[model samples]
Target: MSSAFGATEKSTRQVSTLRRFLRYVRPYRKQVPIALLCVLIGAASQAVGPFFIGWSIDNLIAQGNLQGLLLALLALTTIYVLGIQAIREQIVRVGWIVQHVLAQLRQDIFTKVQSLPLSYFDRSEAGDLMSRLLNDVSTVNQAFGQTIAQMLGNLFSLIGIIIAMLSINLQLGLVSNFVVPLMILTTALFSRWARSRFRVTRKTIGELSTKLEEDIGSVREAQAFNRVQLNIDEFDQLNAANRDANIEAVAITAAFLPSIDFLNTLATAGVLAYGGYLAVSGQATVGVVTAFLIYVQQFFRPIQILSQFYTQAQSALAGLERIFSLLDEPSQLNDAPNAIEMPPIQGEVKFQNVAFGYTPNQRVLNQVNLLAKPGQTIALVGATGAGKSTIINLILRFYDVTEGAVLIDGIDVRSVTQASLRRQIGIVLQDTVLFSGTVAENIAFGRPDATHAEIESAAQIANVHELITTLPKGYSTYLGERGAMLSQGQRQLISIARAVLIQPRILILDEATSSIDTRTEALVQDAIARLLQNRTSFVIAHRLSTVTQADQVLVVQGGQIVEHGTHQELLDQQGIYANLYALQLGSTTPVNTAP
Candidate 1:
């Protein structure tokens, strides 16, 4: 009873998956009926082909009626021509519907992922997501585009053939169907046996794809660390697993496919033996027996096609499951219904008893309180994971505060739409990211409408103007993937240019000058000094020297501000800030980041 219930549950899940797939199909439903109509027309044409042949055999051949035989032959040929045209139309219509659904699915996946909070990406794998978008989607395309259309046409043909056979000779048609139950039982057993193997094949494919993406993305690290052999061994292990899974899946198919053909042969033999006896006994005409043979062939052909389609459906359903799973991920950053756009800023920022955590019931920041007046520079000095970054995150509203409010000019950050809140802020991080675009394009990323002259001016302020102009094609030079053509400091320079072009009321620099050498740092720092004028700024740094000149310095330790004041005031207090500065002065290297 449990086994039966398990089978029923599996069957129910499959039905549910197909129904979900059809929801995507519903938008293109107009095209579906056209394809189905074509299938029915094609089935009708095929159903009568055998009848025409029997008519020609009985009247024209037996009686030697040449003119009647010619007419029957011509009619049969015309019906066949129409059948072929209808089948062609079915394929064309179904193709359009599948392509459109796939396109919409891809678009929705991309838009959904982009809207989701960073927390989702922090736990997800990029390679797996890419596999779903590219490899899995392609699998669905093949099954929907061809296998579904063929399966539909075969179903219609099977029904039409069964009806046509019974109309001509009842007893013979009944006998020809004797082997059908056995065929169905064989199909069910083999399909059940192969189902697990097919699942393994899909899982292995996803793993292999993820491994490949991981290797390619980190090829530089692999080479640098001299772990090429280790990588190869790891990849080979995954590759071998994938190979074994596919082989096992194909082995199931290899065993099952021929058994279906064997059943078909048995059915055909039964028809021939029974029909021959009927013909010899004068219970049926030779032509009638011949027609029954054709009908029997048509009936079994659908059974065979259905078995093949089952395998394709398994693959397509797996793909659909993954695609829908991505779509179901909530955009945790969505704006509230009553969210208002933030107005231009006066740059005052206040954190009131703020508390936060990446996970529930675990606080990363606790009882944090601070205030920065307009145009003031606030520096956060701490060791790695001291909640300095988390403080910045709260101000940006990347994640909402748990205990209190983070406000800009007395307006809670969460009360404003995220787009409007982020627009008036400029940030430059230590690790810069540049897209595949020209030099000018990267500079004007924050302000797309900025003209070429404005881009050049920003680049000049960032001290990267001469460097970009010297590159081939100047502003029009295409940067390859992630700006691979540029050096590290150069990319940092471009990022600074982007932040500079925005003219934001507030500025954030997260170790922004860390990548540049001493010479470039002097130039970039001067430009940054100019940019910071009349703007509220937050600077996070590991090196104590970086924050020494700030208007106010807050020393963070263990998710709380251990000390707060000007650099000299904190030193006079002889607390954590003073001790850290004394230690930094004694040590040769800067403090490190969180692991």
Candidate 2:
């Protein structure tokens, strides 16, 4: 009983998946019936050819009648012409529909990818996502364009031949159909096995692709660590698995086709033997016997083609399952139904008794509360993983607080659309990221419509205008992937320039100058100071000296604020903040301790 329930449940899920896939074809509904009609007409035309040949041999040739022969020949020519025309029409119409469907599917997949939360990317492989978008979509396209029409046409042809044969000679027709049940049984069993194997092949291919993408992206690290052989061995294992999966699928197909052909051959022999006997005993006319022989062969031809289509359909369905699985991933973050556009304000941000975690059991921030008034510079200093970044993430609503609220200007951050909220905030990270584009484009990324004068002015404010002007093409100079052509400091300068161009009401410099040399750090720090002018700013830095001038310095420890005061006040207390400051500045003098 349990097994039966499981099987029923599995079948129901498959039906649901199929129904979802058919929704993509809903828009092309009008064209579909027309395409199927063309297929049916083409099959009928093809089925008539064998009967005409038989008629010519028996009624015309056997009678030695010139008029009958001439008439039969003309009829045969007309049938061939109609059959070719129908087949051509079917191909043209189905091809257009398949291309249109693929385009729509790809567009939808891309849109879904963009709408998904950043957390989705954190846990998923880029290559696997790409495989679903490109490789799997192409597989479905092949099945729709080629296999669908062929399968329908073959079904119609099989039916037409069976009917024509029975009308001509019932005994021969019965003999011709003896192996069809066996063919059906063989196909059903083989297709089940093939579908399972093809699914494995597709999964293995995705895994292999994921491995390749990971290895290629980190090839430099592998070389630096002298782990080239290790990576190669790992790649070989994945490659071997992909090969074995493909071989298993191919083996099933290899065995399936010939089995159908053998059954067809057996059916043909049975028809010829029975028809010949009937003809000899004068129970059937020569033309009837002749037509049965031709019709029997024609009947099994479609069965063979249909078997092939079934195999292709299995592969295509496997691909469709993966593609749809990707599309079905729920967006973890979505705007509220009545979410309002964030209004420009003084940027007075506050975290009110907020508690949060990336997962349910592992709380990363606990009852955190803080406030940043308009135009105030708040510096967060903490050991790594001490919830410094989590505060920033909450402010940006990258992840919502599990309890309590994060408010900006007395309004809940979640109450506003993410785009409008983020648009008003500017961030420059420790690791600078720039797309492949002109120097001007990277700086104008946030405000694409900024004029050349505004772009140059922003660059000048970031102290990178002279450097950019020295490049080969000045503002038009191309930056390669992630701005590989520029030094680390240069990239950071451009990032600051980008933030300045936005003219944001809130600014976050997350270890923005930590990795630069003293000279570059001075320039970046000066630029950051200018950018923070009259805007609420949060500075996360390891260097205590950077925060000495901040309006308020927060020393975070174990996801809680251990000390909070102005820089000199915290140092005067000689607590965690003083120790960190003393260590960084190499101060060893004993100081008075205060609570």
Candidate 3:
């Protein structure tokens, strides 16, 4: 009884998940009809071929006429040629239709994921999301591209064969028909077992893919920690499970087929024996008996095909459910119904009692209030997870504040279009990200229409022009993945250059120089000085030295602003800011230059 309850629970979960997935197919309804039409035409061509064979055998031989034989050969040749051409055209058309539909499904899933609130990414793993977009989507396409049309065509052909059989001889047809129920029962049982196995097989594939993505993305860290064998063992466990699941499904399917073939053979023997009895008794002709044999062969051929189709259909449906589940997730945040565009103006930013958290019922930033006017620099300093970065996030509206208002030029950010608000800001992150493009292209990413002269000017301001010009292809050289070809400092410089080219009203520099050496830091600092001119800026850094020139520096602790003052002012007060500055100074310089 407990086992039955557990099974019911598992089935409920699977059904719920599958229903969520079918939403992805909703957009491609029009394409489905066209694909089915092609399948119908293909099936007609297939069914007609066997009849043409029977006609040549029966009509030409029974009459002993050369003219009838010649005409049958000509008809067979015509059907063969035209059928091949029609089927080929339909196959190609279906391929094109599947590509477009799959592309649309992928695009929708990706766009929806992007629009989801920051909390979604906080709770989700990068590897899992990647698997949904790539592996799961590919599985859905395989089912649609290969399995669906074949299933439909086989279904139609099976029905046509059944009708043809009954018309030839009722008793022979009844004997052949007996196997149909058994075949269906066998298919249902095998498919039920295979479906469960395929579901597990696909899930194992996802887990393996997720593990590979995480390990490869952090391969350097894994190597540093000497966990290479550990990752391999984890991967082996998943791959082994996947192999077992697929093998189990194949074994279950193989077990059903031999029984089906035996039944088919027995049905064929019954037809031959019974038809011979009728023929010798003068109740049936030789030609009728021959045709009945052909019909019996036709009957089970489509049944074999139907069984194969049913197995694949189960797998395809499972894949579709996974893909659609991703598509159905609603975004956590969206634009307000009457949201207005942020107007161009002098840079002014304000946070009024702002509070936020990645999850509900827990606040990471509480009642945090601050203001930054045009050309002013505000620096935030705190211990790790003290909501220093949270302040910057609220300012950028990456996640909306739960308690108070975040304003840009006195306009509520949430009431304005996100695009307009983001356009006014330029960010240079701690870990600089560069695409697979030339130095000029990376620098001018924010403003793609920027000319070569404009790109070089920004690069010069970021102090990267000389370094870029030294490359073999100058500004046109292609960067490798994530700009691995360049040093850490060079990538930071490129990020800065990209930001500067936009000429944004506000700038964000998050530990922008933390990854560089002292010499490169000095160069980056010079570029920072040039870029921050006449721009409102918010900077976060572990090194207190970077905030010395700021107009206002705030010490954050426990999600609140504990201290706010100028560098010298905070030093004199000797509060949290003073201790942090002293700690950074003690760490950055050696005691007495040698101790």
> Which candidate should be chosen as best, given TM-score against the real structure?
1
Query: What are the lDDT scores of the predictions, listed in order?
Result: 0.86, 0.87, 0.80
Provide the lDDT at 217 for model 3.
90
Q: Write the per-residue lDDT of candidate 2 for residues 271-322, one digit (tens) a residue.
A: 7788788889998778877777778777878888888888877888889889
Poorest stretch of ten by lDDT in candidate 3: 586-595
Ranking by lDDT: 2, 1, 3
**C-alpha root-mean-square deviation, candidate 1:** 2.9
Model 3's lDDT to the true fold?
0.80
Q: Candidate 3 on 450-502: residue-level lDDT in tens? A: 99999999999999899998888999999989999899998998899999999
List candidate 3 stretches off by more than 4 Å: 1-42, 45-63, 587-595
Cα error, candidate 3, residue 492 (Å): 0.4
TM value for model 2: 0.94
Query: What's the TM-score of each model vs. the native?
Result: 0.95, 0.94, 0.90
Report the error of model 3 at residue 368, Å.
Answer: 1.3
Report lDDT (Cα) of residue 138, candidate 3: 78
